[model samples]
Target: MSIERAFVTQPVPFADALGVLRAAAEESRLRILALLSEGELSVSDLTDILGQSQPRISRHLKLLVEAGLIERHREGAWAFFRLCEGRAGLVDPLIAGLDRQAPPLSEDQARREAVRAQRADAAQSFFARLAPKWDQLRSLHVPETAVEAAVLDVLGPRPVHSLIDLGTGTGRMLALLAPRAGRATGLDSSHAMLSVARANLERLGLARVDLRQGDIHAPPFGRGSFDLVVVHQVLHYLDDPARALREAARLVAPGGRLLVVDFAPHELEFLRESQAHRRLGFAAEQVAGWLADAGLGAVETRDLAPTAQAEHQLTVTLWLAAEALVAAGAERAVA
Candidate 1:
């Protein structure tokens, strides 16, 4: 008589909950929450810390507030947001779950973070001085048309699904390859250069491009991530060009290619001191050796004839190398 049927309720679907949670899981939103946990911060405080526009930060904060995860307090002219008490009950467990799944930051990440900080500072100073005359400064380098044509010629008729442009100064190479590739990533150590690159890409209405602050010798990208890797006019600036070449090769996917365009052997003492050139120029043989050491083969080097004569008389050379997985494996076995 006491054994009446007991009712049970089904658990909530994690997929639905995750959908809601993911909306708040964005980089800017998460950063805002983490910083607010310390104490109240004005929009300006967030702007400086996150290096984003005030409107951008405000929008993210509004999303969090609307999500019931944070509450905002107005103190005079300033508005600050704080984590909601009961919301932490939801957020804490969620974060703990994520913590367990997250991997520890690697050494490369640490080094990149440091370099990013330095570049940010340097970029601010560099651009502050150069912004007024950026057009003139850019003119000192090769023309956009010529640079674009050179890159396209080297690319040839090959189908490129993914590409990485090392030292993507002003995103010139990224722009040229963006239409052909499914994804294009640009890496450079100078934040100033990346800033210009990002602006250029944005102006061209290209959104599927990623730019990272990193050195050529030790790129931030994962190994073997790109089907086509390019290093244009960047090798001579690095202290270790050979290591940089190897890193470029490492990023090449099997059956993919690496294209390098830089100056061949030439004397430019002024560039060496003024522009921080590591070497006057690289020899084709030297480049071949580096590519060979990196397990790449079928190297082809071409010296592009200059269209006009100038004071520098720079000799532009294009080196094309391929990384075939089957051939590489055979070589490894023989060794």
Candidate 2:
């Protein structure tokens, strides 16, 4: 292979490279690699797509995992597999060499689309059922366009290296900000919501972004993992918004930022009962205090109030905070 076309990672030893090629040499394993090149899929998904037995597909996956050609992550009882990013230098060229429009590969692509289409249909039905309730709440606030514009303005025009959306409902923020992010991930406690997000992202061809079933208060990522962290329209549902902010802030890298979007203080009692809201809208000072306690500095706030024509609507607030670079330095110094 030409040097320019090779994978851009630490050079692999000849022996290890041979092992990867050996594991991927088989016909079925080659097809699996091609399928996963599109997105992550479960064992069941592979069986359905390839029209193969579960045990047969599982065995191939095991070899691929051991060979470091693929990686697997478990969610509940099910596990999903994808091409190992670390192995991209080796695997990418192999998949790229495949003639996708050829017989077996083309057939595999058709079956894969069918599987994803089924998932999309199911997720759409679930969202359709809840759409009315969401629409009702949306009407009670300033338009989403206004809030999104304010959010964009607050974050500025620079693209971030990495971003995580805490409680990413339907993956809206992930999709919106994805163009500006080199890597993006969304975490939510609800598996159903994640399913919806997965389908939505797939339709948008954003298969590169990762989605996981995880809690916002205790996210699975390591400290200082992302350049930007966002908590949008989620704090009102939590009993301890401050604790959640602290956890989200922990993931912000040095010199990174955290952006929060939610409703300002309001006397909306019905929201508590009907919407399962744990708290009414938050006050500006209340959120700033939480951000400060979380070791975030240079806090900036913006409020988007309902227009005069919509007097009864709720006001949406945006809070952008910078990671305390001085605090991070001092801690490292002490350590």
The clash numbers for all candidates, in the given order, read 0, 1
How well is each residue in 1-335 modelled by candidate 2, as lDDT tens digits?
Answer: 01111234788899999999999999999999999888889999999999999999999999999999888876677788977778888889889999999979999999999999999999999999989889889989988888888989999997688889999989999878876787788999887888899899888888767787788989999999998999999999999999999999999998899999998988889988778888888999999999999999778899998779774479999999889994466568989
TM-score of each: 0.61, 0.93
Judge candidate 1 against the unseen true structure and give its global Cα lDDT, from 0 to 1.
Answer: 0.69
- Report lDDT (Cα) of residue 330, candidate 1: 59
* lDDT, each prediction: 0.69, 0.88
- Positional deviation of 7 in candidate 1, in angstroms? 44
- Candidate 2 lDDT at 68 equals 93
Model 2 — which ten-residue stretch has the worst lDDT?
1-10
